[model samples]
Target chain A: MTALLKIDGLRKRFGGNEAVKNVSFEVNPGECVVLAGDNGAGKSTVIKMISGVYQPTDGKVYMNGALLTGKTPEAVRTAGIETIYQDLALADNLDPGLNLYLGREAVKHVLRFPYLDRKKMREDAAKVMLSLGIVVPDPAAPVREMSGGQRQAIAIARAIHWQAGIVIMDEPTAALGVPEQREVMALIERLKKQGVGIILISHNLPDIFAAADRIIVLARGVVAGERRPAETNDEEIVRMMMGATL
Target chain B: MTDNTVNGSNTNTKPGGTSFVRSLLNAWSWLFLILILGFFEIYAQTQTGSTLLFRIYNLQAISIAASQILLLGLGLTLVIVAGHIDLSIAFSTGFAAVVMALIIRTAGADAGWVTVILAMLAGLGAAALVGAVNGWLVAILNVPSFIGTLGTYGIARGAALIVAGGATVSIRNDHTRAFGNGDILGLPVPLVVAAVLTLICHYLLKHTRFGAHTYALGANRASVERAGVNVKKHLILLFILSAFTAGIGGLIYTSRFSAGAANAGEPILLYAVAAVFIGGASLTGGQGTITGTVIGAFIIAVIQFGLVFCGLPPYWQFVAVGLVIIVAVLVDQSKDRLMGGKS
Candidate 1:
């Protein structure tokens, strides 16, 4: 099967310091590609470039063979690439339904003037959360009162609701509890089943192993090595993360 | 676990119970208004041997006073909720008033209703220009709203002064005077106008996608931008809406008083901003309602009118209104703490 997302020779430079250098990767449909690295590694830079948060010094990013380079983050999202930031990028004052629809809201026309269809949006939010095995008891409550796991779930639900072809998650489970982390891993499995391509940036070894179909270790601004989980172990991946030669 | 169940039980209880309390807390401004009215009514009965709340004349007087501030606050409420301020609205009101009166005076006292309508439009147009300038400064130029609007505040003040020749411009027209003071359906014209505008604003803020984005924009601007919204355009539109409402206040000022001064909206600015805050909006944005702002305006109006009715000095009205504003903000802050800290 053809790859859903392709990053070719991505490089980023901040004045004299090169943040990301010659990183190349591809994610096929229904696959999870984890970018594993130590602190100061180029994982974030690479993802930022792909997500259009940063314009690469030199590189190309393609989704479904369409050039996505240099587009705004909003444009990239419109092209079906959703990035769930580490902060979740949620408006704390808004309820899940509003959060789910955010920039794109459902409206019903009255005398040809459109008003928010809040009831339908709320019902749909509940249905989507329920399908993901998460229950938001009060759909009307603003997301600020929600647990970290619930908030994370809401972010994922937003991506899924939009039918994103590719999802880039940056440390989605970092602030979550053990069970919540497991829930996120399960959600990843569900996304894979839905044939969504995922590029996950994670530091947790166990989580990396559990969720990734292939692991790409980055060190000193370049991919040190790439290996399938079945063909590699934790020590090898860690060594690769620490700049060990393949 | 077969399913990763979220223990929403604990979360559910907080909103279900505290929301009741939170809503009650939100209604503190209304409660304060009622409390003050009661105090004034008792004072009127015991001292003057008459009624304060029961008298139609007294209620009309208070509502008319409130109607002015309400018009100004109606738009500023949206501005503040979007995490911005429009200090220029003060002089925007004055500028519109001056322009409208000038048009009427120039057209001659016996000019037809069409002239009056054209003058009103001209007044609104001038105010919208100020709004657009404020929008361009804040949105496109990346200036802080407070400073940008403050700059325009001075400019608008100067423009009003120049347009009115540094004084009030008086007008004489039966149609304009009737519009200003006439009654409709047993309600004073100004009050009726305010009521209709209030309903429209309430619907816009509560039910429209534009309103939703305003709330989101104030809450977290980055989120709205990332959500694919044209935040710059929205900000521009917001400032224009703010100026538009203040312009209406100016139009009413000219119509009701038969004259428009360069400083017509100067004194009303403080009351308008106070009404917004007392209505439960925060400096941090992302909170507040039009209903709350309406109550807030009435609270100020009652305090001002009640103090006068109680035979206090005019200066005492300032002190009383200031005290009420402080109390309203305190209540708002505490309500935030009670609702699980800042969002």
Candidate 2:
């Protein structure tokens, strides 16, 4: 089957240095593709380009073969792609329900002006959290009050709830503990069963093997190697990451 | 679940969760507000030899004063929540007052209430224009909101002065005067307007997508932008809302006074900022509430009026307001730390 999301020869140049140079990748439906690289391997740059966080010097991102022409992040979202950065960006002052529906709020007609359908939005927020099995201390509490793992779950749930066709996770479990990491892994498994394409970037080898069906290694803004988890071991992947011959 | 340090306190003390007392302690702002009202009410009871603050008689007078500053505080809350501060709100309101007065003066006679409505629209339009410039300067040109709106303060003050020709424009129109100083049933028109506006704003801030985005923009601009929301457009709209609301407040103010002058809004501008800050709105942005602002505004009005009831000089009233602002801010910080930066 053709890839649900395709990044064609993605190139990004910041001044004189090419952060991401001629990188190409594809993620088929329900497949998890890992970008394994050391620091400065252009993994972040490539991910940002695909997510429309950065304007590619030269590249084209496609969702199911349809060109996502607009450079704005909203445009990329409209094309059915969502990204979860390492920061797990959430508005700390707002409640869980408010943060979940930040830009897309439920509204009911009131005479002429459209008033917020707060009841509906709050109900939906609770529903989505339950559906994803994300347990938090209080959904009504501010996000700043949440732990790292809970925040991560909320971020992932936000992207998925948007019905995104492709989900890009940048080190989804980097700062999380073992249990939290396991929770994120279970979430990834659930997404895979739902037939959603995933592009995961990580330096954690175990996480890579656990979630990824295929791994693409990049060094110095270029693809170095590609392998299946069954076909390669951690030692080989480490050598590839260090620019040593496989 | 194993970490005691995670919540600083046990989050799951009971299946029903933390007791009502614990919940109240966490909401320190409300506690502070109730204490303020209680102290003032007691003071009034002793001074006047009767319990009278909550009575409909005193509420009319307090609300009139509260309503004037309430609009200003509400605007600042929105601007601050969206990561912007509008220093020019007071002068913008003055400019709007002048705009309304000018329309009334020109309408002469035979224009009826139609002229009053037209003037209100024109005032609003001028206010929106002022807001647009602030938005453009800050959002598009990258000028800091503090500096951008500071410049507007001078512009609006000057524009008001120029339009009024350095003299107070007496509003001859009965309808225009009624809008400011008249009554709706038993309540003052200004008080009723304030009540309606406060309800609408409370709903908007709590329930709307725009309000949610405003909170996000203040918290983390990059995050919201990446989430596919239009950051620039949202910021611009927020500033516009701030200025536009200030302008409406100005119109009502001019109507009540039966005249519009450049210096009319001068006295209340600083108090407006103080009201929002006292309401627990952060100067750095990311958090605020309309309900808090309403109460904050009433606190100011009560203090200002209470001083008079105590037979204190005007300077004492000024000192009291300043002190209350400082104390309220201190409470705001203490509350935040108590809640472990939940604010």
Candidate 3:
């Protein structure tokens, strides 16, 4: 499979501390790649760089074989890169459809007014939710009134709706209950089936073993190794994450 | 864990009808302000009867005053909703009012109509420029809004004083005076203008993408930035809108008094901010309604009217307004608790 995104020698520094150092990875189309790491292992820093939230101190990011650097978050999003932070970054006050269409709202052309195309947004939101097989009581219901699982699904739906070629989810299921977590993991698999690339950041080993096609372990701001889940067990993945002799 | 369990039990389970009623009680702070205002209105009516209400009533006077504040509050609400405050509005209003007045005076009597129009534009323009400075200082220069707007407050006030030379500039023209005293179908001209603008603001804030973005920005600016809305741009626009209203408020004041005072608008800032808070706008930003603010302004107006109607001592009026402000703030705090304490 062709690599949809390529990062080469990525380095990031915050004052004296180096968060991501000499890290490189490639994500192909339609693959769910998981990055497993212990705390403070620079998982977030790497993700931030990819989503254009932070500038890399030194490195290169290629999206669809074209170089991407110094792009704003809005620019990055326009270029089809969407990120779902662990917080879901979903506005709680806005309803699901509004959240889905936020920033990128559709407007009527009569006077170039900024009215939201509620019917279209609702229809599209319903289609996205239905495609993920996630049921929402009301598309107009605010996310603040939603469960952790449903919010996760809504965030995923938003990224996908934006036509993001690569979806980066930070700890997609860490705080979710078993059923909610399972629902999210299932959605990841669904994304892969639809031929979209996914970069999932997580600490949950079983989920890594079950959902990821390829697992990359990061430790101390470096890429420890990458292995196909079928080729390596969770114990070895854990060893790679902690740099331990296991 | 208990809270989670309680929340969990509510998962897919809305509380019973009783909780719905209970939620209304929990949301009492907003409603209570209205009730208190209503009570005062009733008391005023009872004491003075419809006779005083009819005799002393100048629907146009209230409309003109409220409309000016309405415009100012519209912008102030935007800034305040974004978890910030601007105190320079008084100065912004005075400065714009004087600048326009001077220009109109220079242009001659027929220039009075042109002056009023130009003055409004000048006021809006001045406020917007001041607002832009406020936004840049706060967003780019990283100054706290309180400090930034306060500084601009001093500058704008100084400019107003210098322009008028500490003297009242009478806008003495029948055409301009008509705005202050004229009526349309038993309504003040200023009120009609205010009503029109209020409707426009209501639509923009509630129905437009920019308005939604404003709410998102006010609720959590960082998140809104992350969501890719230009936080600085929005902040600038918010301040501009507020100052613009202040400019109009100054215009209305000048029209009513038929002269501009360098210090004429200082008292209005407190009343405007108070009315906003009393109307259910959170000072923390990200929560409020234009409708609520209009009602709040009415409430204040009613109180003032009520006191004078009852022949209450003028000193008591100050005490009453102060109490209303304190009670309104306390009510706002309690409402936050009921809204899940997020704001």
Candidate 4:
């Protein structure tokens, strides 16, 4: 199948420092492309380029064969790309339902003013929470009152809420414990089954082995190699990540 | 592990040790207000030796003074909640009040209530415009709100002075009399207006998306930006709201005092800030409530009146009130620390 996202010769330079050097990869639909690398291996830079958080110095990014390139995160979102950052990018003071539908809130056709159709939004939020198995005791409780795993689930739900074609998660499981990561892995499996292309940035080896169809290793701002978990082992992948071998 | 491992929540907050304490802490300011009221009541009876706790005229006095603080505090709460402050809000009121008085005075006796209405609208419009200017400066130009509003304060007050030619515009027509002295259901019209305004503000902040966004923006502007909401637009809107309410206070003040001087709004600004701070609004933003602002305003008004009734000098009022603000802030810090520890 044709790749859902294709990044060709992506390069990013900040001042004299080159963060990402002509890294190229293709993420096929219904595939989890695990981006594995050490610190400063340009994993985040590449993700940022794809999500339009940073403008690539030189490259072309194609989503479903359509050229999408730039520093506008909103444009990336409009083009069906959603990013869930490590911070979760959620309003802590706002309720879960409001955070889920923020920026694109559901408003009634009352026409008086942009009054939020809160009832409808709440109902919809409940549906999404249920689908994700996020058993929030009170959806209206502010996110600051939620636990870490629930917040992560909420962020993931928000990213997939509008059926985005590609979901880029930046260290989603970084703050999660073993069981929480397992819970999130199930959600990822569900999304992969739905044919959503996912780029997961994680240091967890077992998770990558379990979920990633193709592991793309970056070393010194270049793609060291791509390997399948069935054929390769963590020791080999760690070497590639450490720039010891490809 | 418990389900509390998901996000920032803890098991302690769910249904454990002391929910009564948590709820009380959640609405701590209300309790604080009642405490202050009770304290003053006891002081009044024992020291002043009179039944002046809820006297009709005493309540009116409290309402009149606290009402203005309540209105100003309402707007400031929004601004502060959104992680911004408008120092020019006081001047926005002064400028609008001066414009209003100028319009009414220029229109003369033949103009009547129509002129009064026109003046009020003009004042509000002018204040809103100034507020928008403050918003643009802070939101669009990326100027720090403190500096932006500082500049506006000087400019607005200067403009008001220049417009009124450093003179007080006195209201001679009976059109404004009703607004100044009229009572609704045994409450002064201004007090009633303040109460209604508080309700509207409560609805806007609690029930509307705009209110949610305001708190979100204050808590984390980056999160709001990533959500694709225009952070600048919300910040600007908040300043505009602050200006609009300040103008309301100014117009009412013009009627109550029967004069609109360029410096009319000067004294109320600091007091309003005190009220918001007293109401449990965090200085860094993202936590303020309408109920807190209302109660905080009353606490401030009561302190101001309580001192005078105790035969304290006028200057002693500030000293006593200042202590209350300090104590309120200390209370806020402790509450924050307690909440933080729980998380």
Candidate number achieving the greatest DockQ relative to the actual structure: 1
Q: By TM-score, how accurate is candidate 3?
A: 0.86
Per-residue lDDT for B1-343 in model 3, tens only?
2212112222544546655654674455457655755665566577655543344364444555567667667778767767788888878888777776776666677764666787768766876777788888887888999999999999988888888888878766666788767777777767876787688777777777887787777666655767778878877878877877777777776776677777666877887887778777776677777887787676666566556656777567567778877877776676555444264
For every candidate, C-alpha RMSD to the true structure in Å:
2.6, 3.9, 4.3, 3.5
**Candidate number with greatest TM-score:** 1
Q: How far in Å is the alpha carbon of A117 misplaced in model 4?
A: 4.6
Q: What lDDT would each prediction earn against the true structure?
A: 0.90, 0.79, 0.76, 0.82
DockQ of each: 0.53, 0.36, 0.30, 0.43
Over A101-212, each residue of candidate 4 has an lDDT whose tens digit, in order, gives 8878777655475577777777777677666666667767677776666677788778678889999988888887776677678778877887889999987899889889
Error of 2 at A202 (Å): 1.9
- Residue pairs with colliding backbones in model 2 are B180-B256
- Candidates, ranked, lDDT: 1, 4, 2, 3
Which candidate leads the pack in lDDT? 1
Give the DockQ of candidate 2: 0.36
Tens digit per residue, CA lDDT, model 1, A95-164: 9999999988999998987889988888889878877778776899888877777788889899889989
Can you list the residue pairs that collide in candidate 1?
A: none
Model 2 chain A: lowest-lDDT 10 consecutive positions = A129-138
Show where candidate 4 strays beyond 4 Å.
A8-23, A54-60, A65-72, A108-123, A175-190, A193-195, A203-207, A242-246, B1-15, B42-50, B109-111, B184-186, B341-343
Clashes of 3: 2
Q: Report the lDDT tens digits of candidate 3 across residue range A1-246.
A: 679999889999999999888889999888989988998888889998988889999998999988887897788888888888887776666677777887776666447656767667767886786676666666775666667777787888987887889999888887878877777877888788878899999888998888898998999999999999999997888889889333
- Residue A69, candidate 1: Cα error in Å is 4.2
TM-score of 2: 0.87
